[model samples]
Target: MEQQATAPRPRSIAPVDVEQAEAALIEHYPRLVRLGYLVLPPALGRNRRVLTAHALVQRALPRNRVGGAELTVPAPRGTDGVPSEPGYTYVRQRVLRAALDAGRPRGRWQPPRPGQLPPLLPRVWGLRLFPRSGGADELALDQALSSLSGPGRAAYVLRGLELSDDRDVRRVLSAAGVEDPGAALAEADGVRTPAGSRDTPLLESVEFDPCSLQARPTDLMRRRQHTRAALTAAAAAVVCATLLGLPGDGWGRDGAAAPPYAQNAAAEAALDPAKLTQATSSAWKSADRPGFATWPARGDRTGDRELLRRALAAWARPGRAVRVTATPGTPVGPASGPPQLLFAGEVDAAAVVLLHDGVRVVRYAEAKSGEAGAAALDFARTDAADADTSTAIVVGRTDGNVRYLTAPWVTGTAVRDLLAPAAAGQPLHRDAEGVTDATPSPAPSGGCRAWPALRLGSRLVTDLGELVPARLTVGAPGSPRDVAGAQALAGWAHSACHLQSVRSQGVRSVNAWQFATQPLPGGAGSAAWLCTRAETWRGAGSRVQAQFQVPGSRPGAPGAVVARAEDSAACGARDPHVLAGVLWKSKAGAWYALAAGSDDVASITATGGVRGSARGALLAVPARAGAHAELSALTTAGKKLTTLR
Candidate 1:
């Protein structure tokens, strides 16, 4: 009787509502594009790769007849009853299958006939490292994909591009209809598919080889994660290692004290009390520059001596067995005056070189980056500034393999209160003995007032310098012993390569070895050092400290600066040995920079050139209500002085 009213209840619906499905797919397009970018290499131009992948995704998904802006049909769901993470499994599976199909050996696995398959297989492109932008070769990627069965190509793409984690990657392979998806995925990880091989002769004119990326996908994954950490740690280690050695030859194995020389004492005295003088002022001042009272003497080799004692007390923890040794064969000449300092660090290999005369100290990486060579695996730089009282230059290195160098163009106290101890004593060979007998002391007797310059080394400095033993004010993480000895060896091995370079004079026999000594009782870690005889030339004429650096790193980043001093006396009132400086990234990200006295800012490009700018005039005295004489004098004299401020 109610047939009219009950008429709607009798109809059974089809499994998938096509009209609603089409609507859902329209909504899914945006997700498809994002997923494609994530799955593909960044080097692939954004437009082409993503658009193609989107089109492919649209065709693959179940669609509805309603095709305008709105999706008319409901999207499909897995048996698990959830919409998957847009690209998580399905797309990953497809990409892998696609890559495999393109690269699989023709005879190893049979392929389905073209008539029975998806229309776009021939249009699919296997991903390539360097894809051709526009030309006949442009279709090469698609051609490669067509050679594989769908499932094989998907496996190759996902694994090679670093798209997903292991378990998920497996699941994706299975869903793509791959035979023994597990085996194929694993094989995809290991063997080079023909289409993917970079060097393999091409099936067509296209040069891309999908197999070139073949590797245990997990192996590639592990490498990617470890690189960042490894590079940072190695760089820091090198800086610590090299700077530690700059002070002196470390203590000898048995432990004996060395003697301090007049040159060492003079270097120490020069830094004690510098006055902030004008750039045109004479090198020396009437004030007796008070040397750091706690600074170690040249002969304090055993690390347990009085020099280290004072140094540790004043500067914080001092490493044991610190020593300074002049390169035995270096041609010793009359003192040019004060020695100019230089610091260098490399990223390809974890190594830092501190040069005063010869390579006063050197440290190397045992592993990581690439392979240790002159190539810019890491970036470096150097800088300098006037600290009101004195002038100093600092060189810094970073992970990207870049270096920066900065210094004062004119002689003023450019650097002062260098934390580096005087070159003294024989090197200590073990970590257990890196401390001095000196009693604990206070903060720097006086603030270090000087002009500062810095050098940027190639690559990031990775050593957690915070972990080394240093003055608490210096921010070392732990006592030096916490990371010294063989444990430090691990640091060396974790980098891309060790730093090696021919000295400017080109002494073929130069060999510098750097390692950490035993931790001292006071919790200082010392760096051991050794150098052979060689010839060195300091600057005399225009004072060009030619520093070679690998840029490629953000500016103001840390690096190592190597300085040569033709006349040590020229560096009077400044620390002539070694020092470290902070590197900040520049706005454009190319050059490293530093500012001196508010108005002057100096910038050093990655390629190594110096340029400076000044903001305002200070020479003219401001007129005051009561000070007529000084104002009148400045007004008259200031008019005569004309130069860009």
Candidate 2:
């Protein structure tokens, strides 16, 4: 959250042209951060106020950065006191809701013991924007804002500043996790106009620009820029130091439309039913990437395995979604297959229990990895799920892959097409369809079976995007619209806080998944070990440095730690991102990494040791941490061009 322009925010909730939406977001950038500054104080902490606000803004940046679709959000009120702006109210309400939700106290709420809790509205440290220049006035406002309950505070902000209709404010409040909307409304009404303060003191003031509160830190920003440039130059100069680039943003194909794959879908390699049960199995295995392990392996092969497969199929019904996963280190109990009670990877070693309900809401309880996962919950009971809720729920992986359920019945074709190519040459089951049915598939006269038939004509769809008159595809489940009829339901409400709370969780979760797969960075080495804590202060995201011991680099020489990939899942044998580096040490025992590259055969053979090959050259010099030396460039083929020492 540096005092700099950040990734763009969304401009509208309603589907609009992508470029127009981006411009709208950029136009409101400053105001958006200010709103975030106030709302996110609780979650991000007031201490690093600037950074936290920046983080929230950055978090709102869509997944596909350059050109992508927009997410669903409550449409703005046309000049309802507040001037009209596309996505203004939409982004604002979402930012506020995100802050409130993030700042919400976890677990059953209890008043903190007198001395147990830190003071409410502790003084803001990093960056402050307000009426008091960090004086009593600012503190008073902070006290007032913090004093209000999460929903109460949100409701107050909406009505007071947004001038949102009262009903609309309350509706948004309910969407922000208020169990009782009426209670939240009552609380906001009582404090709509506090005794002596205006709702938005900082915002309503003439001196509202945040820069007025503090001078720019040009030196720090400049230092960051220079450091990256220097480091990149040194990295690019080495033989094996490969290039890294951000992911492309195109969501769908342009130019020419290929023939619909459904016609030729038969050519796809057959899927292996047994493969689905393995922790490391996928229907879409390819030479460059591993098959996804989210989907269950073959069903109908065994009693419990068949049940699990039937459960997965039922969950994938049109309205249901579910994906089963096997966390690493979990015991592969006998060849019997993973049961409902399997180890879940978590800090407290929680186990993820599989639910029979057709929707997915992977639940974790307070327990150890191998100790839990036994108890399952009704899909409705998990995170506001209701009777129409899915028996199983599906979630997408960091890569655009999903293993889960849906509602209604479409023949097994959808599941088959969605599955990784079945094991290349396996005999096909003309009726694999029944096993993959969203509706419960009957067990072949046998061992185990799924109980209770699915409720018909009771499809669950809590999202408004899909229900909207003309739904947009850019952002969904994460779109801001929490309810379809909020605006009209709230008689006096001008703006609806179209919310997609799932997006909030999705943004953080993707990084969590990305960061979790560290042991697999495709570096060629004897073995790599974790050497440092994950440092997330890299401005963009967290990263950790690790080293693998390359035997012949030098006697007693340990491998040098280098930048690890943030999204290692996308990297593979042909990874363009460099992976491992050689150790350059001085007699004084200080060491530095001269260069790093993929540890694949050619790269490892070329860059590992001082003893060089005709096709490879080792650029060696006495280097220490933060120590820079002139570097020479080499072609990918290892041909040397003398540029500098």
**lDDT (Cα atoms) of all candidates against the true structure:** 0.26, 0.32
Best by TM-score: 2
Q: What is the lDDT of residue 91 in candidate 2?
A: 52
lDDT of 1 by residue, 143-248 (tens): 2332333444455554544334444445554544345655545545543333333653232222132212111112242344446546665765565467457766
Distance (Å) between predicted and true CA of 644, model 1?
33
* Candidate achieving the largest lDDT: 2
lDDT of 2: 0.32
